[model samples]
Target: MKYGKTLVNDVKTTLKVLVLFVPLPIFWALYDQQGSGWTFQATRMDGYIGFYTILPDQMQVINPLLILIFIPLFTYLIYPAFAKCNFLKTPLQRMVCGGLLTAASFGISAGVSFALEATEPSLPTEGNCQIRIYNPLDCNAILTAEPYIKNQDIKTMGYTNLDIPNVYGEKVVDFSITGCDGKINYQTGSNLSVIEKETLFYYMLPDSFVRGQDDIERDENGLPKIRTLVNKRVEDFNLTYSDSEKDVLNLPSNDDSLFSINPGSYKVQSFPKELKFYLGGVYTVLVSLDNNNDVQNVEYYEVTQPNSVHILWLIPQYVVITAGEIMFSITGLEFSYSQAPVTMKSVLTAAFLLTTAIGNLIIVIIESAKIFEKQSEDFLLYAGLMVLDMILFGLMAMKYKYINMEQNSDNEELENKSERKESNAIDNPTFKHNDDDA
Candidate 1:
């Protein structure tokens, strides 16, 4: 009877240890989703929700809510059934089951990725445009005049005097005479002189010219006579010149002469309306000026869709990470307690909690380091940390040995004391003696 009672006690202790360990793996699996599966799945969801901005990580709230609800439900409803069932009476069994579920989560995510890819359309090409201006010049003209006087001492003959209007529209007495004298002379009526002696004389008018004036009596188009000008002032006339006219006016001869002058304005027409795609599934457009310094083109483009494999592959990664958490975080908790000395059970539980606290501290330290030294690829850095975590946990599992407190002398003594008390009660029959005295 003592042996049977001892066996029962041993079974009860083992069962209690198993029960405590079972929940650890489950909680760890759920917690790991915060970083891996939940984060990975969030990236695939669209942010637009009518008029609100939604951060991708915000989806993680669902995991916490699930944990809050499921933890209690599982403790009350699911844990009892496991306790009654023989199959779930071990930490190893619970860890294995948790790992399988974690894997299943990743499998679901992979399936979702494929479904999303099949439904989504190919990205559209971006469009762009550019403008340009060619060349420019002023379309104005300049004019100048000079006067000449005559010396009559030379033997020269002069023609009759005539009145002519000057550029100022004032009538002036002038003489146009031809003579053998090489020098030409010009005089106003007030300075005119008559001499009886006949001599050869010539008169030359000042080299004065009108600007922007018509040169030919009939223009090249067979028009009527019009005064020709050397350099015309376009601004004075409030006139604007076109690109073709500006080209003709800017010619060396026309630039100073009254032929034509080009003004400094040109309108560009050609602009591109398309662009090419680049990496990261990110689209970009460019707009710039042309060779002629005009607005060249604005380009548009659509980036290629991300490889379907990326999303599909991450799903499995999520599952594996969750599995790792189940193995290390959850199972480790139970392992720590089961391996600890009976007197230090609370300390062992504290150590299990400390692992999580240390993990969080590590993450915080990494993030702070990033603040000091900016990380170019934050996602890669985070992934590397996770990989490190998995490695560390695996190593710990391999090297660690569970405590065998059941064999301790102190525990054996406590068990023997309880057994002796029970035996004394059976041998002395205390209850029977009390009833007989009554």
Candidate 2:
């Protein structure tokens, strides 16, 4: 069934639609980051708000939540106001504004990233050793190291981090721990090699001390790595997570070991410690004892404090992006349908979706390239790309002739009805004889 009359025109219209769609993928690429890049950014931020805590992944809810609010707000208030101003009169104009807002959202994110980077702890330089001490004793402990740290006071049940000269093979650094009065209690006079560019954590416990290398490996998706430093007293412990159970056995007195676990709230049985773990975090759980040698409490230390930057800073970016989504994505689809030829609606819709998939592919390519060392740089780069894409889209939109498919369909239907009536009168012999008699 070939409709030869409209075939050429439909093909020409479809080609124009494809040209207009060329820049849409970039918009989707930036918009889709609310799930990936934005969520990851939230993971490193503090989620506490008064009495309630918002998880990093839960930040995505803001998009949909705002969408519901924005849809009615735009329909009733915003669009009406814009109409009076003679702005955003067409879908193309709305989509262009949407793309601009998307770029602006990334600009906000980049600003936030710059702020966060300033507060973030600096990584150890090559040929340097970064060490943090966890003193779980009832009294404060003063640590003295030769040739580097003179006297650093690590408070009771608290930790202090320091960077020192790296000790390579065949050499050892002397370390002494004492009370506040400078009375030496523990000393490491033997050979202890410290690696450069690595973080070493020392746990001070009752009757013994343990030291382990910090594992800064991030959790991918929902799998987080948990390193448990069990006090010698607790023989075995069972961890009940949200989905599974992990039983740790026979760890040495005050010894720490690292293992991966599903991210969730964990209940440590046999010692009664309930804790919640977030995504992409490397955690150090310390089970300490009191003066009476009984189980004191459980302590948690994250290698990189994921909750340092506050999550509320993300609100501005989210708001802008959601607004952009309402404008760019929805309006783009609407524009595609309205401009499409009668028989080409389905094909254009599929092409619109294909642009979204291509946008995601762009993300993969950028991520794999490892172009930027800092996340802030990555955000700025995306923003720049979005601006460039919007410029191209705007140029295409200017040249695009808006075709009213509904009006054409209505006229075609009217013509078909008129033709049927004419045929009926011509086929009637009585009407022809009446005309001949008249």
Candidate 3:
């Protein structure tokens, strides 16, 4: 009971100091994301900006470099100016502000992540061919990926899927490739459309087909014509099948399958409404776009896959996070040193570092679960939690009784004055003469 009473007294006295440590863990979590969250985000981004190519790992350099620059800039230039205004008067106030800023940075990151989702979209794996007909009319031409099949079975997976005849029962279809006219500077992965009664396409190709080379032969339209791609010629109709459905798959009639191709350009752009491309295909998700037949020059938007995100987008996040780090990390270290009792200073420093390890442990646990599927959602959660933590810290900080170092200063002054007096006495001529006589 006596020890318990003493412990209560210690807690009562040091509650303010303990509360300050709360935000430190959250700060570390945000700081560490530069290595994990942000790095992976950059992997999906277009890294090339003009002359330089910044890899995903290289994005981490922004964090440390910003920390180095912001610390001095804030300490010498910004803090003093704020100090004069009496705005950030105490350590607690600064820490709360830092927490808020960290939250804001994550919020900004969340927004950017939403924008990225549009370009690199996911597909719904419902069926074999998931055609998301967002609008059939506007898309007069479909931008299909260049044909190159990687299959070992020549008889099964081949160009035989395109066996549909026209209304006249003749094997002639409205197949035409409109070369990119100078009018539209369509980038690779950009969407174009064509209007026909029905169009059948082969999304898959036989392994025997040549991938690197394009088989070109032009029709009267001056557009590059698609030569009928045949893998293994069907020389023998008498074929053996182990599986019952094998005959239906091996012998192509007039229908669509997972391997059937759609009409579109090799160059494409993904949009909001996306259909699931085949699992192991280059095109993961596809958006079917159509035009509204309004009279005045119909303007269609194209969202293309950028090779790299402009490195400039990283600035706001880096700036806000660094600001938080400067305030939380640097100030916390100084606080742990100055506020701790002289004998317990080492113990306090270790305690401060332990918070960082705890923060990392939290991240490891969260990542291991793979709880949040979308990275954007994960960042949003980080932002929200950070804000809530800041609010709690602020309340604690407001009640904190800042430690007084005046007594320590007074003791140092007394020791310095006594040493000066002793020096003066030793220098006195009378004292020196007496010592000589003795």
Candidate 4:
């Protein structure tokens, strides 16, 4: 320790690193949302790109994949250009630039979210009910419901959405579908009790099936719910799960039956045909007759549109955030190691990592407090916070003295030696007498 001279330098270096830790957790809090907030965002968007569909959970892979590509690109090409321009000369500058990019990425996400809010459909308000009809038959069908929706012609395989506010709750209403030149005149006065803020999906199937009882249970995890309404007698009805589990499901003829299953791809095999189910969905499948008026098919419809905003909108945000990570995350670690004293390198690294935990804690606290009304607003708030954080970090960096540990150690050794020589001179009476005579 050179009689504590080196220890002073080491302590100072440690304090500087600790100061850098202040703004770091905010970055981590925003970055770690790839698993939670970002995934939830993907769920509201459409995952279809060409023929392949991307899952919301799979979006997390974009970070690591971009890291692999960005590491080399920055190391070999991008950083060199910046170096030539006399830019980002220090690790601190790169980290600041990276933080700005992080803020920019979230800004882009906010814009996408605003677009989603505009394009996506809204749920029925309190005391109001929404309904959509699906016509799977080949012939065009005319739907009629007095005092709620006008007589509209729904084309073959097309659907129409209607919103009704307090349409005689628990009271029966006359609803009819006419097609096939009036050969198919289906009428019903059943009380389709579509409660307030609930969506009822009705499919006009060519089968003699009665409306089944409604199962009122809702899933807490927000997983998908599937309900099968058997209109006719069918055999070998089953659901084939992607996780290699198959169950022989049977719905009593002309009754409402409900079943809950995990979220994944599932194939429903029955007498009519096969239908595939997606994740986090609420679906109702009705067994019905084909255009032949003979029971031979089943159709399923969802309560809400699963993918209205395309997943591709997320790509730009992901790219920007990944680039920022490549610049900020990697440079921060390097700076922490290089500036730390040799004996405390590992401790500073651990301190740098602790910022991530703190960032997550901030998120948990704010979420529990319900500080924001909308997620877009929350994102904007984070972006704003990050900007302020970067400003503070940049100011701190300007004051931080970048030191070479080896050079500092040598200087400390020289200072210690000089101090010892001065002490010896003061202690020796002959040296003091000679100095006094001179």
The candidate with the higher TM-score, 3 or 4, is: 4
**Residue 234 in candidate 4, Cα distance off native in Å:** 9.5
Report lDDT (CA) for all predictions. Answer: 0.37, 0.76, 0.50, 0.71
Q: What is the lDDT of candidate 3?
A: 0.50
Better of 2 and 3 by lDDT: 2
User: TM-score of predicted model 3?
Assistant: 0.55
Query: How many collisions per candidate?
Result: 52, 0, 29, 2
Which tens-of-lDDT digit does each residue in 1-438 have in candidate 4? 354766776887799789877888999888988888787777766665655667777888888999999999999999999999999879999998999999988898888878766754476777787776666556787777665666778876566767788654544466666663543445544544455667665655555313333332233333456776543344543333233366545444433455655545554443535555444455666555443435465566675444467777898999999999988999999999999998789999999989989999989987888888777888898899899999999999999889898887788789989988977874556554556677
Residues 69-115 of candidate 2: C-alpha lDDT, one tens digit per residue: 99898878988899999998899999999999999999999999888
Off by over 4 Å in 1: 1-41, 49-53, 83-85, 113-281, 284-335, 343-438
Our tally of clashes for model 2 stands at 0
TM-scores, all models, native as reference: 0.33, 0.76, 0.55, 0.74
| Structure candidate 2, residue pairs in collision | none
Cα RMSD for candidates in order: 28.9, 6.7, 17.6, 6.1
Put down candidate 3 lDDT per residue, 1-438, tens digits, no spaces: 355333453355445466567666876777788887886666556555554555567777787888888888987998899999997766767878888888999998988788766655232222212111111112232323322111112121112112111122212222222222331233233121211223323222111111222111111111112212221223332111112222211322111112322212222222222222111112211112223211211122221223234546877888898898888777778877777655456767888998889888878877788879888988988888888888988887777766665565466468768867976874556545556676
TM-score of 1: 0.33
Candidate 4, lDDT over the whole model: 0.71
> How do the candidates rank by TM-score, highest first?
2, 4, 3, 1
